[model samples]
Target chain A: MTALGHVPGPVGAAPPAPEASRRGLSGYLLMLPGTLWLAFFFIVPTVTLVASSLYDPSGTFAEGYQMTWHWQNYTDAWSEYASTFLRSFLYAGATTVACVLLGFPLAYAIAFKAGRWRSLMLVAVIAPFFTSFLVRTLSWKLLLSDNGFIVGLAQALPFVGEDFRLLATPAAVITGLTYNFLPFMVLPLYASLEKVDPRLIEAAGDLYASPFTALRKVTIPLAMPGLVAGTLLTFIPAAGDFINAELLGNPRTRMIGNDINDLFKSSVIPTAAALSVTLMAAIIVMVLFYVRKAGTEELV
Target chain B: MTAVASRGVRGWLGNHAVLIFGLLVLLYMFTPIFVVVLMSFNDPVGRLGYDFAGFTLYNWKNICEPYQLCESVGNSIKIALLATGLATVLGSLMAYAMVRHYFRGRGTANLMIFLPMASPEIVLGSSLLALFVNANLAGQLGFWTVFVSHVMFCLSFIVITVKARLSGLDPRLEQAAADLYANEWQTFGRVTLPLMMPGIVSAALLSFSLSFDDFIITNLNSGQMITFPMFVWGSAQKGIPMQINVVGTIMFLLALGMVLGGLLLRRIRERPTA
Candidate 1:
């Protein structure tokens, strides 16, 4: 489920016709518009962000920033917002783990058990997306409200008090993140699990391997590409997400995204740019490390 | 015989354990959606609009009662339509090029397409803001800026979706069409386009949804204009109108209808003719 995994076979695999390969000019022509759009909006903007990060910190929107190339902006932003950055990753990590746990059984059942209802089940999984994201998150706020049933149920525990609440806590932010991104995990997992040959599992069972053992050994290894893809998809967006934190979390639970947004709004352009660049760089580094460790470099 | 029957019952339960668990997860996923639907009929007595005060048809009947809500919805629809159209056409052409014809720097082109998906929205939004700021377009940031960004991000998804469909096609079908003495344009129009329609349609649907629901990037670029998500965000800070839930419920119903309608159409088409 890497971005290119949808494309069949290896890159530059045999063209359908010899003339297809020779018509490179047409290929380039077809690519030109999209390529130029990406270059202008994606690539150039990214470069501008890096440059903005180096601008003089003292400058304001009114004063206009100068190209001071001040390297300390990185250190300044990092030193000030390190905890927020760490919290974002921690929340995102927890959300990814939660999504995997919740999503796996659903994806598994949809793939192996649903039979004729598979597509319907898949649509059901994505149906939540039809609603507005904010509205759904708002419903979560209702669910986790202090006087809500969920909190009342939580307060019933022996260790919990009547005052126990789910909202305005780190738990709330993480729950919101997990809920929002669960489909990302499930869809990829379903895609890969759907491809797993049923005969392989039957073969394992015939070999006297227990169901759990077969799942751990046979099913999981085959679904690694989707697992890796799903986790990255969940983690990357969760780390950068501010809506969950802003809506569900208290001020103390603020993530890097919240800080970056606040900084940008307050006209601290250089610091905000610095934080944005740092977040992107950190995510890229972690993704590379993860892809390498997962031994699925080819998928990417 | 009693013991054997008991063992068979146990086997049935064991087999269904995963299915039961999966159903519970699905329930959890749909709970909020149910809440949104339920809230559309809520006659809230307070500003928070958190609880179901009383069930009434007022919110649904007067959906446009809230100031600027309908206007924002209109803006979102316009943006979504335009962005989806542009992204689908450009992306399908690019996907066709990538899959049907081999070219230099294909690897680099693929990487360029993939990078935007990998990057977080915060980074993407902030970087674009930075670009506009530096380019002296900060004052001009509004609908067009948001539209450009929407197309920019939607392009990658469209490419991937259409590329998957294009590459999955049987080359022999096109070759057969050519063997029948069909011209290039004729072969493409009659064969390739029809075969690729499902992918293109899906890509367009995906792009429309993404553009319509976008907030993070839109929030950064939308200086004075209010889109639906932006309006929702603004209301979240102040007071939420119950009509917002009405809008949410409508979007949900519309999309679900389209999907189910498409599925029914496909099933009809796929049925063996007597």
Candidate 2:
């Protein structure tokens, strides 16, 4: 509501109100329902549920049951799942790298090389999104099974050891995340790259700068915003995702997502909620940092 | 011009490298999907490696078998359509209100609408599951809970796409219509609606595909009901069934066909006006 008061009232649709109080009245009225829905569904549920994570099996909030905050639950979660966070980070980091490597060239080609076909390429990049991530990822389980094509290829690799099962490995987790988030990376990158003027590249060539040098000094820095956005999009989902781990990885490679989903369905709500809260906090911190760096105006 | 001065074979190769590299990238992007679709038709008597499967539709016929697996596919399509329609209407009104109508607390409202999208599905699915149980609504949680949950996610997508279009529009065009003695309703109907139709269609298509593909939230909410994702998941745990591959292949191709069709139709519509 307070944020709404800052908006320069609705400019076009309805007739303008008195100049003095327009922003306050129109802003507050229009923003009320959306804010209320968030309060009801998001803020309330998250806060209360995270609070309830302190409850022990006796349903008391504290050892003494005096409504004390038992911060030990947070400590306990770390002791129990110390490796899970590292695994989540490792998996997400690998996925981010893979998507960048796989997606950047496609984006570069689309932005610079393709003339009439840019929109069509974008449509193709986004088309796979029509299939659910679950369906698409699960389909990989069949493709990357012990008896699958990749399995044979792995065995054929000269120095590899015997009985390499690609299905239930960390490699599988990375492969799945990379496949799922490729479009997210490409879309934002294209948005940035498409804005780059073609004349600049020609000017660099005319100035006798090598193609490689021009890309390194010019194109990369210009597309930093999209790269940042794409990295966040890939990393955030990869960290939170339980699907890839559950469908593809061995127990050793299961990330925080698998941890949360595993605990939630098994009636271990408190600890699951605690992990979720911690994960949510990490995401919030990252988002705040990116917003500050990118500036509020850059992002919607 | 050093490469230009090398005007024979090497220079030609350098120029073509981008196109070649691009073709390779396109092939890479297209590979996993290609393998899945081709392998879905693997004949028992054909080559051991299904990098090439004999032209066959055996997998498609597997869906006709009298099993719960087939039922799940039907259930998934029905849920996706219902959820998409409901989300689209709610979201469009919200978009219209945000773009066209001035009201209070709009910033907070906007934040609330988009928050569901950024909030991870794990949190959302569990929260909805807990709420359903605590509220004693599991009996009614079958389709209704799933539908509502899908709308919560889909609505933000709809609003974003439509709002993008609305912002593109010149505000004075609508104002000019009003100045010519057209009422607000008539102005919207005759002017705003026709102009924003492309975005509206895109939003609907996006919403439908999203709802169709959702698995996590649907799984948490659907008690005895099974969507295609759950069916594939449960079957994956047992061992990846041949038929599930069939389902996946069909879904992928069907999605590709529909999206390409929609783009083509939009292109046709644009030409007449252009």
Candidate 3:
């Protein structure tokens, strides 16, 4: 991801160069505190989680659990929560597609068509997110309530029954997920799209290609890095998010996150740990496969 | 004449199509925010469902009327500030090492920094809870545990942000300071730190927001403690207080004010030079 690289400075200017000489002892020393923090708080926790997954189911956290190498925990958690896992991916995947459809146009517009309003548009994209997350989702609950204006409108549509409602539906959950993560999709897409040379599109237009053809042939390929980055950013968090599902979905629509949260809350530590590890592994494998399939090895 | 007029209209629409579409998307994003703002002023006729009743300023004036709402908000602010301070310091150093110094296992360090951001929040929270419980620190899951988790997550973001800023910086400026007979400490304090201030400040702001808005991670680790999100989640199950919307509105306004103030300050500073 470009998060690791230097974001190029103002257009047409060279980015700053890194120091060419190798740094010695001081470099590792400088990294010591942060690396230790990550090791203890981040890496160690992940290791502990994997270990906890193998703990015997009979033990509790209060009484102390034992590491029994309980492989069945994985199998049991997987088989029972398979639907939840599938639903998480499905919702996340749909949210990613929706974000791209909605965000690509917005990013493209800001990059090319916004003119003097570019910064204003960018601020607008981020401003809504600065408010409380739970508060915003709660507002959605209000907006989609059975007697709310949106549902009333939906009821008026053809083939929609009078009993229809938006709240506690998969549609509401997906909408919440999409709304919350749209900025993630937009920012990277804007970063890449803004860097695209305008002349290439103009050249395509001059060569008898229509605007659509120019966009498809010239622009889409150039924005591949951003598309991949935005999709992953949107999808990964969307999959892991339980707040929307909990706030907006009914019991039947529970994702893996909800299951994990409930299990952890109810003191089902081993199962929760196993499920958490499985979800993480699944995401990592999917990401690696995606990066491979997209042939964008520059992503790290 | 009619055909030419139609063609002209088509051309105009073509030119502005994406722009129009984008505005719509932005509108969609802000609709819920509008609801939140509107609901803050709402006078609920009923105890529960979130219909916008008559407008009133009662909720705004009595923001802390709800039980533990203000307390939870105070806790969140305290935790966010502490987490931001710690994460920014550690992260800035790590970013400096990654960008300015070529070291062994540099690639591994970079991977470590990126992995937390890549992992989902549920996994992060559960894994951290697992760690705490395994270490026999389950009983100690409160502000400190939440603080630890916040810093862990915020570090990756801060490092990524500061690394980008540092990588975009020209090393020659510091070299020039050295050539002018300045000591290393003097150069760092006067030249490098001043130049890096914007990045550090923005990274701090980002970390604060992330820490403040976090729910799932905090909820899992925060045993018997209530942050603002936890408060909201609890209230959601019961009847929600209009005061929650008041808090949300105030937060939005505060953040907006900070952003605008920063922009204004930058413009004022640039004016004399320009």
Candidate 4:
């Protein structure tokens, strides 16, 4: 996690001295190429996406779309694909919660209990990232297959029936999402928890607090920044992800990403653009609300 | 005496409980990779490589059995290399500027760098596609378009990684170098650059993996070009070939070897100095 270790540090830290006085045009010169690359590719393209979303729905790619200021595109897209949007959010929300439940303990152990094996454990957490993404997702598809061990084991449970299956269900898709993004959640949580002094926990214990109470009152509050960051990182991408649904889920479980990709493929640009913009806007609003509630504005 | 012994046992269990749970979670994380490695040697009877019927080394022997798999892999390697090089250089410069020098609009610049990272891949891909279409380059979308988009996304990650490495440096080293009558270029080249090399290398590695594994953005922009992920995606809709798992296994092994090798080298190097 060394590469990703310092990401959540204070973003607006002051510039170092010794070069502050000599910085005339050299700073701008150094910043020019990269900043211009981002400006042209990232900033301009976002504006294009927004503009394209409002194009008239009747126009074709061959005939060129007209800027009809069609505010109706939003309503039309929402009316048609609202369920997909909701499903995306639902899946993403579920994935985030599952990640927190699973990731917190793993992160906690690595932070405080792993001792000298901490670096090795951290490497293990991120080792999955080296493999190709699609290949790993395909492995999940195999693991959750109807005749696979997982499903067979589930059937052996008294509560589950003999015909029980895990594949092509919301559970499977959520499982895939949780598994794929677990590292994202763990890393940030570990980053923040690693900074917690043992003395603080001991202090809480000496003050007549139980171990659990110390964790609740002291450790968790200190880990809020990481929690906020981890959740956002997990939720935003999971909400926009379609790979799990496409592979591990049935047609009924398609997320907003599936539709966006389909619409784009079918040459329905404005609608796809509308959906993309809507997803971005929805994520932004939720993230803003979340960060505000969590009181970590500097994370952004 | 019995009561005290039982309490000691209970305390030991309590202390190890979280560690055991953490190891289980790590096991869960590696389950898919285990499946992948197992399936790499699988000899499937049907077109779909779902169930492992028998053991065979056929997939490893002929990894290029699937048409266009190797080609797509070559393209991915080429793109990843080029994208990593460009992003690393450009991003290191930007990081150097942001950390070492005072500049106006620093906050705005930081925001600009952060936005691309925070945005979803779908949004970034679609936005890039939208820009291409607006520029009348829709029909011309190919390797270059995908390359540009890869660089665009990889740039922010490189900057962040390098910036983290840059800002953590002990500035007094450079001050010490200057006191030895070293000029700016000499001090930077000899001292600063050497220290920053680890960060830059890690940043390059991060960008390479990001660019290589990128499917969402590349899929949107690549009109007719098929990268490795795109190849797997296409085959996934049909029946995936067993050779794909071989590729997966190789990637995992290569990356693991490199990282562990680096760690070993670092340990060995630090011993003598320490």
Chain A: TM-score in each model: 0.91, 0.85, 0.92, 0.91
**CAPRI-style docking class of model 3 based on DockQ:** medium
Which stretch of 10 consecutive residues in model 3 chain A shows the poorest summed lDDT? A1-10
Binned by DockQ into CAPRI classes (incorrect, acceptable, medium, high), candidate 4 is medium
For each candidate, what TM-score against the reference?
0.95, 0.85, 0.95, 0.95
- Alpha-carbon deviation at B122 in model 1, angstroms: 0.3
Predicted candidate 1 versus true structure: per-residue lDDT over A1-300, tens digit per residue? 121112233545544532344364788998999999999999999999999999999898876899999999999999999999999999999999999999999999998888778779999999988988988998898899998888988899899987788999999999999999999999989988877777777778889989899999999998888898899989999999999999999999999999888888787999999999999999999887766756432343
What is the C-alpha lDDT profile of model 2 across B1-274, one tens digit per residue? Answer: 6776677677667765665566576665566666566657765453233233366677667654525778888888898898788767767766766777766655666666656666677777767765664455645668777877777778788888887777677777887898999997899899988888878888988888778778777777787888888886776666444565577677777878877787788789899987
**lDDT, residue B256, candidate 2:** 80
Model 1 alpha-carbon drift over 4 Å, by segment: A1-22, A157-159, A293-300, B1-6
Tens-digit per-residue lDDT, B1-274, candidate 4: 9999999999888887888899999999999999999999999998465799989998899999899999999999999999999989999999988878888988789878877877889999999998998888989998999999999999998988888787778777888899999999999899989999999998999899999999999999999999999999999998999999999999999998888888888888999987
Q: What is the lDDT, from 0 to 100, of the residue B13 in candidate 1?
A: 84
Interface RMSD of 3: 1.7
> Which lDDT tens digits does candidate 3 get at residues B1-274?
9999999999889778989999999999999989989999999987454788798998888888888999999999999999999999999988888877778987678778888988999999999999999888899999999999999999999988887777778888888999999998898899988888889998999899999999999999999999999999999999899999989999999988888788779878989997
* Candidate closest to the true structure, highest DockQ: 3
Residue A148: error of model 3 in Å?
Answer: 1.4
Writing each residue's lDDT as its tens digit, candidate 1 over B1-274 gives 9999999999888888888999999999998888888988898887456678998999888888888999999999999999999999999999989878868888788888888988999999999999998988888989999999999999999998998788778777888899999998898899999999999999999999999999899999989999999999999899888899999999999999999999989889889872
The order by descending lDDT is: 4, 3, 1, 2
* Model 2 interface RMSD over true interface Cα atoms: 4.8
Label model 1 with its docking quality class: medium
